[model samples]
Target: MSFLDFLASQFSKLQKATLVESFQDDLDSSVTFEVVDRKIPFLPLFDVRRLEFQRGSSYSYSAIYLNKHLRLQPIYFAVQRLTESFFPKLSSLGSALVLGCAGCSIPRFLALSSKDCKITGVEYSETMIKIAKKYFIDDPIYHYFLLLHDDAFSYVHKTTEQFQLIYVDLFLADNNCPQITSMDFVNSISSLMAGDSIAIFNSLCLSKEDCMKFASRYASSFTATYVFDHQFHYYVVFAKTSSLSTLKAFEKRAMNFVRLDERFIAP
Candidate 1:
């Protein structure tokens, strides 16, 4: 199938699955979620909060947000760790883009971590964007955010602006969007990145073999790549240039994240 066709098919299927149902599938602990807010869409922009029983703290996800602080999920902690570690001085960064914009967590975190950083989220779901603005982002636009709307690919194609940080965390329901695995899409996205930018991808897979296959394709699109695996998921970070120096800077901060995210790192 063509790229747009594939995305449409997956997106249609995801819309059939409610956001609450998707989160339910992801968190299968019989825990109940207290509804915070919701918007009826093809996929309901349902926001709910629950106590992570194991962790003994409340967490939330609505199509996106995973914590009150809107932090990256533990599964995606490395993406944040690497971003933090690589930057050294976070405020030096200028802008960030979050593809998929699930609850706008990355943008939220970036705002807190860097005052100068402007964050733009590209989300296909207008309902999701509305939910985010009302619930998570809650920020006055034209100043902090360019806003989170539009087809991600179209936005990538038209925007002349480049970003220091780009997050590729698109998902439809519980499935990873098929288009994200393509090298063509990766290359198109790379064109919108700054010279020293980093792109992090969240890949969902049924097994390690699947992760490896996708990682190989993504690795070819960047100068250097790092893969972190957990269960059936693989997260990859690709550096556009200064591969060695970039990894070295990231290594200096490795110890900072090793303890917290180590358990999920598959052997």
Candidate 2:
């Protein structure tokens, strides 16, 4: 099967996934959390577990587990693709910051992608941080990862240190953090990026107009802005320079991200 076809199959499997474990955090009543397992039909051995948040009638897959031994994320396909493709360009950089510490999937991926790069992740929910540690990042591979239990909004405003790579993924279930599209948050992210660095935002769960508006907010702070639609979700990229075109050139390997930046600004 083709790459798109394979993606469609994976997406279908998630939609029909079976619930494996369901539980609640007594400390946090903001959202109900669950652990689910999804596998290809008729392949019981090919199992992948995921952490999800139940919001009303919908579910958002926050992290996916291939195996306890592997430091990779199957749900964050777009961020993984963009980072792997763009990280090499910023060779001088050795630091990355992830605003949302859901399962530390992005941090884990960053660690494996660049061993020298120091990774820091901040999560707003203390319970969520505990859940990540207990379920996802218990392995010794995360010994060097700095995990902070703090609100992303407050942390960004107070942080003075800059990083070559930053990721914004503050989500509650399928709903995004309302502050994610605010000017203050955008400016904070801009301040965190070092020279010629890049930032990736998980812009899903927003309407098309809202997504474009959010991307436009970064145009004044960054040299180029690009948006990619992969796995039925939108991801926005902001960079100090126009280095993201390489991603468009290698669409086949990257699973063909539908570029939507042209609708608002030229990148």
lDDT string, candidate 1, 1-267, tens digits: 334334434554333222322222223344333324332244322222211211234444332333334333222555677687767788677888888874665676677677668888888865555555555566542257766578787787788889888888776555577878676678777887898887777765435556556556556566656665543346666666655666666656744653222211112
Candidate 2 Cα outliers beyond 4 Å, as residue runs = 1-21, 25-30, 37-46, 55-58, 66-72, 89-93, 242-256, 263-267
- Alpha carbon lDDT of residue 42, candidate 2? 54
Residue-wise lDDT of candidate 2 within 97-133, one digit each (tens)? 9998866777777765566778889997766776787
TM-score of 2: 0.79
User: Number of clashing pairs, model 2?
Assistant: 0
Q: Model 1: clashing residue pairs? A: none
**Alpha-carbon runs more than 4 Å astray in model 1:** 1-75, 140-143, 218-220, 230-232, 255-267
lDDT (C-alpha) at residue 180 in model 1: 80
User: Which candidate has the highest TM-score of all?
Assistant: 2
Query: Relative to the true structure, how large is the alpha-carbon lDDT of every model?
Result: 0.59, 0.70
